[model samples]
Target chain A: MSDDIGQKKGLTRRGFLKSAGGVAAVAGMAAGGVAVGARDGLAAAGSMPKKWDQGYDVVVIGTGFAGLAAAIEAKNAGASVVVIDKMPVHGGNSIINGGDFCAPGTRLQKAAGVQDSPDLMYKDMMKAGLYLNNPELARILADNAGGALEWCEDYVGAKFTRLNFHGGHSVKRANQTVNASGSELVNKMLAKAKGLGVEVKTRTKMERMIANKDGRVVGVEVKTGYRYPDEKTGKTAYIKAGKAVILTSGGFSNDITLRQIQDPRLTEKFGSTNQPGATGEALLAACMAGAMDVQMDWIQLGPWTSPDEKGFGHVPLFCERLVGYGPMIDPATGKRFFKETGNRKERADAIILIGHPVIIMGDSYAVPKQVFPRALEKGLENGAIKKFDSLEALAKNYNIPLEAFQKEISRWNSFVEKKKDDDFGCMIFPEARPTVTPPFYAARLWPKVHHTMGGLVIDKNAQVFGFNLKPLKGLYAAGEVTGGIHGAVRLGGVAMADCIVFGRIAGKNAAKETAWG
Target chain B: MTRKHGNIRFSPGWLFAAALAFGVLLVYIGTPYAAPKQVASAKAGDCAACHGQEKVFSPSHPDTKAMSYKDCLGCHAKGGPQMLQGKLPGSHLHQLRGVTCEKCHGKVAKPEAVEEKLCRTCHNAEKLVEKTAKVKPENPHTSPHYGTSLDCTLCHRQHAKSENYCNQCHKFNFVVP
Candidate 1:
């Protein structure tokens, strides 16, 4: 009976002899013809079979901005590309992202009368990243961001309809998409990728990269028809990558265990804004295949999220717009807290130290003029954002001492009148007004795991570097999967730029690789 | 000792036992049926057609052997003593409404999963959005973010308990079915 079961599973004689615990390992060996110890004995790619279950010139593993961008570029470069995603949905976090593409100098910036340059943008990144950023990679992103944004606008046909400001940027450089969601760009990219005959197969997950005896990633072992978060759902198969394999499987923000290993403070107590599939399995698979990782402890937390909401809820849309124009108060103290315009890490850390949710509030003037109407309405509808008729009422709603809160509001109003923040040094926008308006809006602020600043180490050309300190041939990575561009911290809206820029580079370079087969 | 050793050698008796054991193992692991048989002439109360004589409902409920959707609605109104809309899977509702399994799945050896387009054939997404515009918190069919293109299966699973897909990212307590 056991022997029949072994035959049904396509297990070899040796595989059948192994214990049930060794089934998975024996299965890989059966297909690759490399025993467990023999694999480590080889200096490079192990001795595997010549035949493959499937073949593609370039296999891209992800369907987010980075993966789609890579697929489109590789296909355009004349490579027969196939993009695979483990999720049932095509886009990962990119689809749900807030659609802020930061570029140094773009038409949107120009139309908004904002003076910005790539040099200045690079400076802001370096400052926020604590100068730990790889200068070469950061330089590449800064220089090419505008060109990439233009490509997304002109070539991909994704419209950037508005210029917005992110906390760490020097100017209003974030080009907001038409729908204010990354879907506007991701859907367009998906359409373009499909139009170019780039086959995108969802529910197909890469189990591991297959390297030859020379340590070059030649292909990948994948499970087709895989359902995400269900380890037992897919049937294993080997796919031959004729040229290269691109890993753009994004970050580990949603990976609590992995993130806690890197930054112990990031426990499951903190929620993430990423998709459920935004775990570390794919990135760790690359590491198991000899890929190097760097600065993995540097995870970013978004301070704009609300405890009252889920995932990256509409509170972010409300809070981001109100920052620099309103005050974030520690409800416990009923007074102002950290600089509202502080970078993501500082603000999140400060809120954690406070040990309770904070309140970010804006008046009718700021709420109407600054916040997106849809977001404000939705936030209110969800009961995360509340509108109060008076300053006392707002304070009472959040259980803030009315006397202290009123005094703080008066102080904040004085700062607005003087165009200076006397206390926490929040960036005060020129259009700011006092909080004396009849209707006041507020949302309780808390931190949610937002982005990972570390991943696979790659060079400026997007070729992944191996643990052996050599470029892993036939391997490339881009977007959130590859790190060192953001270094210690990734500023807001820079992810879109990073993904688009490096995705194109990885795609073009991957296609240029000599086909091993 | 020699005889005992000889008894352990390959023999037709032992081989027959091994083959029989293997057959039993195959039956244990393999599915008994290829797919659920969908008879076009089957009635709503024909439990034996698909489920055999297994008791699927509580004993306290009226005998459903010959009951249709209208008969069930007599006791289980939209929001009455027993509402089945949110209580049962969408396929059960279809079955009760006289929508045979072959209607949506068609006559096939094995039925495949249906897409949102299949649901839209009967229920228009745009009209759903307009109809539910006044739903207290907000409309579920359309949104400022995804608009009306969200797959119906995300919230209207036929074979399983329906879920509010928006709850993954928002605090919308929508009673989806």
Candidate 2:
């Protein structure tokens, strides 16, 4: 039964005949961790920040989880710390993220008698991230799953009541709360910061790092942020750092310019789910700080698409899926980009099958019932889609090829309705699968720039990697700003886990800094 | 400056002299009396009094709110708080909103009946104004945080210490408002 289960899960038939304890490791990785780049060791990117201002003990850049964690640590260790962020709020994307912690072999999961191990978790993560994630980070995440979970629950007030998500978890280790809101997580992190006497300043945009003669990172040059009315008068403040700098600003999922630079097709077609401030300035900053970069070509996508570019803004994955019905499609072809699957990851693989999408298709049945009507209404509402009683009428309404539409529907029916899709190898098809229904529908959506894979690479200690192949003296980075996490491709939920885990590490390391001068 | 007085004899000579002085003041700055307009005038004073600290949970906040820099610097020299009680009141807290005593406490001492009379003018209670603080509690500080006959400013740093200082050790069960 165990061997059969392994095969069913697509585990390699030949792996370590390790003990049941090792299953925890394998399962944990499988549950919610991705490991890539385990072969040849990573080389150094060779850039460093020198000390500058004398006022601060530790200066953190980017206000996401990484920056916050570092600042909290630095402050508690009897050093004055200043956290600088480009956004109006702290915790960057972490605050806006769904509270589904993908920790494997956690105390919570174990307490529930759920059998899980770090090895399995690692293996699963490697698979989900498609072997593009860093193996070291993936292993650590699996190992510390229990400790991280306990910290999240005890210190940071994460309710973690709900522990389920459809991302990269094999077991139910993704911790969410009752209300299932990101604000709940953000609010808790903020509260925990206060309990530890950490000073938080919002609207304080960090421009760059201040380095001394030796090029040691000293302070961050910040401007009086968004809420500060007189942004023009720009308060030029420099909070000193005695030990290190951590950056956690989010990725460039929404930056039209960055998206265009990375993937123009994605920018022009599929829209972003990130906030308005989803620019990749942090990427630029890290590069200027001497970090090597990669993975600019990769990005994450969701099934939810709209005729009007700004689709459902900032909806959580599952929340939107609840009402989001049907497959997305190309209004021109009335076909689909990939084998239509209910599973989003499989759907992603299908979308990227070709360098470009052949077609985008979906019906009212396949999409969430609530989402279906809403999407159709939005398209028709926005004049992007036309509604008709029949496929011929629909084709004529939108100037689509009537015969082509008929043929496409027949093909969809053959594979979908008649269950003859063995040729196309499409996944399960319910009533919503085929477009053969009386009134068929179609819309156009292309991929867009979803994320930047390049970030400030870090060691197991979460210390910034220098060009010299050693960890930078006192610099650390976490969150989207630090890459080598989701190696070649990033799974949907891995990004959030990276933010929390690495953010905590950056904070703990920065907390132990000494006033050098 | 206008003179504070019960009577002012409006003479043509006096009015002419005032006009001449005002004209000279304006010319010295190379501009007409622009009324110190919003375009150029620096809006200074109490930056924290209006903008309280913004928490991730809370809305926007003031930068220098803990120990009202305006209150302290209103009399002292200039600048935000450097150090008052060895420990600098850490970052700004939005939780400081509920209480009303810190505005005039800490670093400087003030009497209570004097404090009560001062308080009642804005929040006037006919019979309640005359009652003792210990006998009849009014504010958060009135709940034993202000012991017997002690100076109000002894522990409270209006713009320095957070109003939720007592909350340091106490777990507050927030009934979601």
Candidate 3:
């Protein structure tokens, strides 16, 4: 949920839980139009906006990691910025995430002495992404990733806590947020904007891009009327630009049609981690103006993101942080998908469908809280797992699977059975033991799109492209909008890195151009 | 079966292909090999006159009244409220760029006086979906869309944003990019 707009969901226990920036996103779209004095001028004169205001050197669309990064960097660069959102809330999914997850050069990485290099990082990621990435973007991503993490810690006030997800990569890149998940990062960005004299406009929807005769961007027409200030009247107005437009909109994971089109099987089965504002407006506009789209076919696979509900699609994943470190058991095949390979696309896709027999079992507090009770009853009733008064009884439930699970149990049972993963490589290891004592438990998990790899293409300079593969003048793109940066699939902590790295680049360069012809 | 256009049949099966075909048809339609139009629209005169009333920023300002079709930008720059909604510089969709309001809105002295049917008359091709794209789109009465007062260029990014909007413009994007 965006700090701009959030609501109390049923997860009130999760603390005044918020919708994923719905209101803030709407304001971004609406206010963006109003700020631009959008022709069709920002909701036809007096429209209600939550936080609408006008004028800026740059208009950064979307408020997730990319947009947030762009806004912060642009303001720091001395250009007035208006960070607009279609979601009523501003934080987006970045806020609801487990903060202290993983990243290199992170304090956690230094402490662990994992012994790594950016080249090694890039090589490993390329292996993970199957080498389907633009070399330049990948190198840049790996080289500066650590600094970006540091920027978050230093600028965004992200507190560093180390956790071993074992999902992807080496070293501990997932850094924990000292505050509430990643809201600290989002808040830090908002605070930075306030400091930089940037305009924060929400509830604005991007209506259209007004370009000049030479096809250079002149302004953007946005729709208003929800709840914002400093917007144009009902008549379309123009917010001329001195530089480029940066779109940081997130992927269309929640869009049903988009999901189906991207991958019918995944969308048909497991729901993706997309919020409502993950609509295609900004992305499509960039493409219509001639940006090339890349690698859209790949989907991020996460077994838990899909919950217990079963139709063609509707799954839930228990919170990763709350679940802690646990071994996911495949019930259908009665084996582990190795361990912590969920973050690796190949590793995830290879074993996810080996018959949905996966049950994540862990020590200490790995037993899932929200759905644990129901899952325990279901496991015993259906015989997917056997409930035992002791570990022996649990063993009988897995007689055929004992040989498989035994390895997992013994590996973590020792004080240092395996600090460095020999199988599926994960830098940090979970502290808990596999011994479930008297009470053994397990829960269901499903794999699906955790993120999107497809987006608009850009040159090394980050200029937006046309149909002929030529850069569109006065048009620049970055963040998730620029594909080929992450290879075919993304590394876990790479999203934040990509956002910061390219967002800074795009903003710096975009600011140099004049929007008006 | 309802006819797609004049002779083409409109059926659910061929609707998509028909839309694409029509989008291609829009590339070259009944016109004098229009690389450019002399009098793009009859209303160009009125738009240039009144656009200065709002926030005078149309690209064609000072020489707007005196210049030919090309020099309108001298007096009126591109931000005037009237000029923006009226699509002064042009529509993102090239076909609608140079055309005057009279071509689609009709040549009546007042825009409202023109029969809405005149818009539908040529715009009935919208059922095909692809043909609905226009450089100078008709009034919503002819092909209803949201945020009408706003320029389609301002918000509606031409490329597929993601697969989600395919539901809204199913014909435009059968495949999610």
Candidate 4:
């Protein structure tokens, strides 16, 4: 099936390399074409190494949710699998993630009496993604998410005890882990994978994909003993994958140089919520190996992060909970600018347009009721979340016009009382009360580069597509590394679902591939 | 290229210039301002052998030539204001504690990176976790992500300044020693 596409393209490996090199040279001379140029230039398949330092049936890049899930599934499928991470530690951004696994018809959802289905979840994803999502891939994610969640629970022994709501979702469907962090799942998955005899190595970075003369990916060139951010370290080595290689190296939100190349507005001025190792080199290396990328410019920024705290701090928990129960006030005008329940992109863009930090506040009633106690406490301890005894005090702290802020609070309270926002159509929850309670809590809001919604293009089966618009044989990808799942923006909790659902698929299919050797 | 000097055939000016250049080269090589040399067999207190007379201690500091780890603790006691717990690199601490370079790196002429298992030879992972269980904020020895399996070098860098790796994403103010 894969060979048919390659034959139809009618370009042999030699011809393809020549043409790609020519195109890269031209692209290199053009302004703002460095990524494309580098991709094509590096895409030239490497010469076969005389010896392989290590061999496995499946070699997975990254140790995040997707890579670990893929390793476990591939191992279970009877393949000798090896997972590698460039970082010294295992779990990538997955460990630091706020564990919100969005799946429809979940046990938690049912227990909470919130009706949901895969179809509803699919619609919400499409709506938030601006209809740019690959419908087939998105459908696969929606359909398989429930089973994946069940696997994570029943098979992997991870616990999900809470049902929560994220903005842009139809209902409360996020199945949050007991610890409220993705480490609950990732660490469990790591243990499970290791128990199944899967070899996991850290500080092993993939330098490039090595494809055979037939244009099939056969292995990867790597730097063993790698010290990250120090390219001078690590010894060059090769690892042959007898069957296939899966790329789940994740997004490039923290790569300031690469992010700015894609979107000039994403300068160093904007902080990122991702781990320091969330760079684009691995994804680019795949692109260099004939993989095609899409929607690289549709980077997602989190609207809830604070400049006061560092990467994905406790303030996000405080701010995300306060939305809809209170108002996000532009301190300059003391007015609500955008809808509190709007999607991530809309809220972030609105804040970016305002040119400075804004405020998201909830009174004592909303704060204590909506916010997680631990997050609230930590945020207060860190001084990211501040308390004010009265509206005047809140306004004084943020330098908001006291009289105008007082009037705005009254107007917002009226909206909450009526369960409607007449101004910006913010979704006012039914249980929300007036913001007249003393000792209101508020946090400053500034957008941080959160997720990159674009990456290597992949099919529904998790096979990566090449620049020739055909499956790149022996190469599979899932999670944030593969794009067209969440189009323009990724809804808050769907990333976990996407990684697990497709990661399993990639692993299984990668194991099933006929050994090229 | 031959200079026509029988026993002293070079021009007098050139001879003087050559002597001056050689003296300058010797001074440059002898000065401690260059990179510090690593002498695997040197004593922990013999700083001058590797440092080439570099002033590593303050002028008021007492001589530490014969001081062992216990002897140094008289003035630099644990938890004291002058404590060297976090101030000194882990390698120096290890040296002071009598774990010489050969203990982990072996007697190889060129020392390479040491694996975590070597660290486990002296510091039991489970015992360290138990020892630090009562640390404020959270225990640094074990975390939800890596548990007790995290590479010790990630936090306790031997040759370099140690850092709390958790502070990259979190605000854990651990004085990593």
Better of 2 and 4 by TM-score: 4
A138 Cα displacement, candidate 4 (Å) = 1.5
Worst 10 residues of 1 chain A by lDDT: A15-24
User: Alpha carbon lDDT of residue B119, candidate 2?
Assistant: 41
lDDT of 4 at A347: 89
Error of 1 at A6 (Å): 20
* Off by more than 4 A, model 2: A1-54, A106-114, A165-172, A226-233, A258-270, A307-328, A342-398, A418-420, A429-444, B1-177
lDDT, candidate 1, equals 0.84
lDDT of each: 0.84, 0.52, 0.54, 0.87
Query: Please, what are the lDDT tens digits per residue for candidate 4 over residues A1-517?
Result: 3343334355443443234243233323431333344444334665677999999999999999999999999999999999999998888999988899999999998888889999999999999999999999999999999999999999999999999888789899899999888999999999999999999998899977888777789999887888876664566689999999999999999999998999988888798899999999889878877899999999999988998988988888898888889999999999989999887788899999998999999998999999989889988988899999888889999999988888999999899989989999998888999998989899999999999999999997899999888899999999998898999879889999999999999999999999998
Q: Is the docking of candidate 4 incorrect, acceptable, medium or high quality?
A: incorrect
Best by lDDT: 4
Scored against the native two-chain complex, candidate 4 gets a DockQ of 0.21
Compared with the true structure, what per-residue lDDT tens digits does model 4 show for residues B1-177?
A: 135554656677556445444434443444445677888888887777677788989989888787788988999898788888889889889988899999989999999988788999889999999998998678999986667878888889888778888888778878888
Give stretches of model 1 more than 4 Å off: A1-51, A324-326, A362-370, A387-420, A428-440, B1-42, B47-55, B58-60, B75-82, B104-139, B142-152
After superposition, candidate 4 runs with Cα above 4 Å error: A1-43, A389-393, A414-420, B1-43, B107-110, B133-136
Cα deviation at A253, candidate 2, in Å, is 2.5
> For model 1, how does the per-residue alpha-carbon lDDT over A1-517 read when each residue is reduced to its tens digit?
5565445555434433343333444455654543343336323334454679988999999999999999999999999999999987788899988899999879987877888899999999998899999999999999999999999999999988988877777788999999888999999999999999999988898877788877778888888877566564676778899999999999999999999999998888799898888998788777766788998999999899998988988898899899888889988888997898887888999999898889999988899999989889888888899999988888888899988988898999999999899898888989888878878999998899999999999998899998889888889999998888898889889999999999999999999999996
**Interface DockQ of each model:** 0.28, 0.01, 0.01, 0.21
Error of 4 at A391 (Å): 4.3
Which 10 successive residues of model 4 chain A have the least lDDT summed? A22-31
